[model samples]
Every structure is written in C-alpha cells, then in structure tokens.
Target: MCGGDFMSKNPEEAMDFLSYVADVSRGWDEPTKGEVGKMKSQLNAYNAKAGM
Candidate 1:
C-alpha cells in the first residue's frame, strides 16, 4: 500500500496524484468509491491551504 504522506509535497503534486487516483478508482466498488471521494476532499483542502 502507498502512504498518503506523499500528498503533502505540494499542491501540483497532490493534484496529479489525486487525478491518477480518480482514474484508477473508476469502476471500483461502492466502499472504494467512498474512499476516493474522501481522498478528493482531502486534496481539495490541501489545495485550498496551499493557495492553489
């Protein structure tokens, strides 16, 4: 499993990472879809914090 700590690097990096995650999460089950949504929310918060 990959550690989410990598997301703290920078807004651009986080956006790219989340975009990849969104792509990979496509067609996933309901629970996994929920997780992806949570991840997207986190990424949004991070971007906001970074003024992206």
Candidate 2:
C-alpha cells in the first residue's frame, strides 16, 4: 500500500473495474454456470448501489 493502489477510495471506480472484469469473464468457459451466477450477482450489486 505504498502508492494508493491496493485500497479503493471511489465507488464508481470500483464498479467500473468490476464491470470490466465481468465483461472479460463473459468470454471464459471455466466454472461454467458459476461464472454466470457471479456475474449476475455483481450486476445486481452495482444496480443496487445506484439505487436502481
């Protein structure tokens, strides 16, 4: 934690990062159904954060 990189300070930024992760994970085949479930959970979480 020497460069303010490990800890997250912005909710929007974190969501953006998680969105990118979810997008890339969409192309993978590992974990099959698990990945989809996790992705959906993340999406719901983001939406709830935005109060949508």
| Candidates' C-alpha lDDT | 0.80, 0.75
List the candidates' TM-scores in order: 0.42, 0.42
TM-score of 1: 0.42
Q: Write the per-residue lDDT of candidate 1 for residues 1-52, one digit (tens) a residue.
A: 2385875668887788888888878856455777989999999999999999
Q: Judged by lDDT against the true structure, how good is candidate 2?
A: 0.75
Best by lDDT: 1
